[model samples]
Target: MLTEERYAAILKLLEEKKAVSVLELTELLNSSESTIRRDLTALHRMGKLTKVHGGATSINGVYQMTEDKTSVRHNLHVEEKNRIAQCAASLVHKNDFVFLDAGTTTERMIDYLHEQDAVYVTNGIVHARKLAEKGLEAYILSGKIKAVTEAIVGTEAVHSLQRYHFSIGFFGTNGMRAGDGFSTPDIEEARVKTEAIQRCNKRYVLADPSKYNQLYSVIFADLSQAAVITTALPDKQLRSHTTVIETDLGKEQTSS
Candidate 1:
């Protein structure tokens, strides 16, 4: 096949899978590794794709792209995430400096945090608005807005977070593997999450059972960094690594 045809085929595969590795392309195209690398470089230079260390990802293409991320944000773990959020919310103190990451689970924590005397630093636009409505001090980091998750990322977001320290941080990940660590679909979101971890004294990962033992495109922070992990029912491996806070949402809610 010609180089042009091979490149088109490569992009087609990426559209279906989101990412493609050099080894996989080599096997599929029956081409040498060096040739595949050249193609990736050329495509990246043409603004057609972004070349990562081991693979290439489509840039601004029709590969399951969504303008409104709010749809996928909710309905991930409706019941479980709400319970986990409530549990995390209970841990927040009156004057603690809390950092919240962008996730469906973490977003639910906003309602429970209402009327609290705390300063919240978050990269999530939705979370920031919720915190403001709750009468708390909310600081939304400014940077490039990621369309997929509606989270602020890029250099500005990282720089803004570096100056402040949080008492605790509540974050969520796309996937969690014992070896692969905490992963996300977008690399930009991963970068912001890494910085947030450094700016916090204590960190908690909020996720559901579905995220456990899963995988994503980018690996940001490792599971070991979590001070505590709040989930519905995590697997045994995750429990061994961190303090897993399990909650049963099905149980009747007790009045305060």
Candidate 2:
């Protein structure tokens, strides 16, 4: 097939499947893997598709500058979030000092947490309340609350985070891309997240597959800075950058 014909075929497949791997494209187009890879790279440079590890995903529909309300987000990817939360919760041990970022997935982590002896610190008001209800020791940072995501943010929150170093911290990101790393829309929240991660010995970003290959306004942490806890990694190359704990719901196994 001609290069243009191959490009058209690849685009049509992406429009239908939203993502496609080089192997799949090569077989479909009766072409070599090298040719498909070059086509994907060209398309990626042209902004026609997003080239991810082992595959290319359709360009994200929109750039989100504003965050969805907690109520709305709580309903999205519920199953994946729960699985990711379960894996994250299992990482906590007795007497560990943890920082739980305000997010739907992190909030779900509270439900699976069995470590009552671990002390928790959070900028999430709801998280703090939930932790308390579970009879876990919890502390909320002193700061201004952003109503949209219901997370505490401001210089006060950043300063409060600096005072104590946490054994582990779980964070949420609006976007996670290869080079840009983890990002959120709000600058104030990003500041708080940056400070919180800096004060932790180990950091984990709780995200679902949909969060991959997206970029937001403010970047809080680099891809290498934290291990990603997700049900599956869309991009295989991500493993070369940082640790990714893929959670299997059925077997409850994690692979890095």
Candidate 3:
């Protein structure tokens, strides 16, 4: 087949399946794996598709540059988020210093958290209040608040994270892709997350299955930098690169 014909065939298959592995494409097109990979790379450069390890996914599968309001996001994937949150909360021990990033899933974690002796610090305004309501030791960072996510972000927030190292940190991300890693839309918020991750001894990103295979503008931390806590991980290839805690298993299943 001609190169253009192969490209058309690849894109049509992607449109049908949303994602296609190089092996699948090679067999479908009666071409070599090397040829399919070259096509994928060219398509990726042209912004026609997202080239993931061993496969290619449609561009539509990726997230947008803008984030939804907190109220809107809070209603999505409630059950899955709760499962991830419970698993995250279980990891917190007494007297540990925890940094909780602002997001609906991370906020859900507060309900399951019973570590009253653990000191909590957050860039999330609502998280701070919720922690206080639970009578947990909590501190809210001082910084300019972003209205959409209601997270405190700025130089001061990053500076605040520098003062003390956290025992474990739980973060939220708008997107999680193998290449881009953990990402959020806003750069300042990403900065805060990046700083917090650097200062923590252990880090985890809490996300539902929908967050996978997505990419955003700003990358906060690399995929290998943090373990992911989720109800399910749709991408099997991702498991090979990082630690993933799948909470929906009868017991927590850790895969690296």
**What does each candidate score in C-alpha RMSD?**
13.6, 6.8, 8.4
Pick by TM-score: 1 or 3, better one: 3
Clashing pairs in 2: none
Give the whole-model CA lDDT for all candidates, comma-separated: 0.74, 0.85, 0.85
Per-residue lDDT tens digits of candidate 3, residues 1-256?
9999998998888776556777778888999999889999999889887676557777665556888899998986676788889999999998899999999999999999998789999999999999999999999999999999989999999888889899999999988887668888899999999999998999999977657777888999999998998765546666766888888664544556
- Candidate 1 error regions (>4 Å): 1-68, 249-256
What are the per-residue Cα lDDT tens digits for candidate 2 across 1-256? 9999988998888776555777778788999989999999998889888775556777753356877799998987677789889999999998899999999999999999999789999999899999999999999999998999999999999989888999999999988877678889999999999999999999999987657777789999988899998876646545556778878533322334
Cα lDDT for residue 177, model 2? 79
Which portions of model 3 miss their true places by more than 4 Å?
1-60, 251-256
Q: What is the per-residue lDDT of model 1 for residues 1-256, given as tens digits with 9 covering 90 to 100?
A: 8989998998888666555678889999999999999999998788676565456755532321122266765964466578788888888987899999987788899978863677888999888998888778888998999866878999988888888899999998876666667777787788899999988888888876545555677778877787444433323455566655556533322111
Which model, 1 or 3, shows the larger lDDT? 3
